[model samples]
Target: MKISEELKYTSEHEWAKIDGKAATVGITDYAQDQLGDVVFVELPEVGQMLKQKDEFGVVESVKSVSSLYAPLSGKVTAVNEKLKDNPSIINKDPYGEGWIIKLELPGLEEATHLLSADQYLKALGL
Candidate 1:
């Protein structure tokens, strides 16, 4: 599985890039691969508040539907509107164009608790 060295990850296979007080979030490459071709995505509204690990949305693939969790608490500033039309971008570029949300974080308290790229790989036994 492809993993970005700059991102933090969750045990659930989500990845985050924290920059200043904001973050970009998405499923890992491993996650999209396991899910097969994605058919649909359910995204949260832009103003919604999410806590760490809260179920924020759903991703429906040819194989299964998976719940997306918040890797850190924040106000949702944006969602990937492109996914509504072509969810397969997730499988194509999970760390870039496939990113799911942009969060305006309150602090890094929860961010510090997340897994590093190396730690995440170890958790997956890669």
Candidate 2:
């Protein structure tokens, strides 16, 4: 499993790449691998507010359907519309082109509580 050192993680397998209160979020490499080929993604619209741990969207893969959770409280600033037509990109580049959403964080403090790369790996028993 590929864990990004610069990104913070959630126990549920989401990753948040923070930049000046803006966070680009997505499922971890391990998550996409387990999900198999992604077929659909239901994303939150821009301007939608989300609290930490909130169910923001859903990802349907060949293997299963899973809810996408918010790792931090924020307003959604962007969604990866590209996934709508070609969800398989998630299988191709989960941390790059497959990133699901971007959030405008309410505060940076919320980010601090998320897992580090090592912590996330440990949680996976790696």
lDDT of each: 0.96, 0.94
TM-score of each: 0.99, 0.98
Give Cα distance to truth, residue 115, candidate 1, Å.
Answer: 0.4
Tell me how candidate 1 scores on lDDT.
Answer: 0.96
Badly placed stretches (over 4 Å) of model 2 are none
Listed per candidate, the RMSD to the true structure in angstroms reads 0.5, 0.6
User: Distance (Å) between predicted and true CA of 121, model 2?
Assistant: 0.3
Give a tens-digit lDDT track for model 1, residues 11-125. Answer: 9999999999999999999999999999999999999999999999999999899999999999999999999999999999999999999999999999999999999999999
Alpha-carbon deviation at 1 in model 1, angstroms: 1.6
Highest-TM-score candidate: 1
**Which stretch of 10 consecutive residues in model 2 shows the poorest summed lDDT?**
1-10
lDDT score at residue 11, model 2, on the 0-100 scale: 95
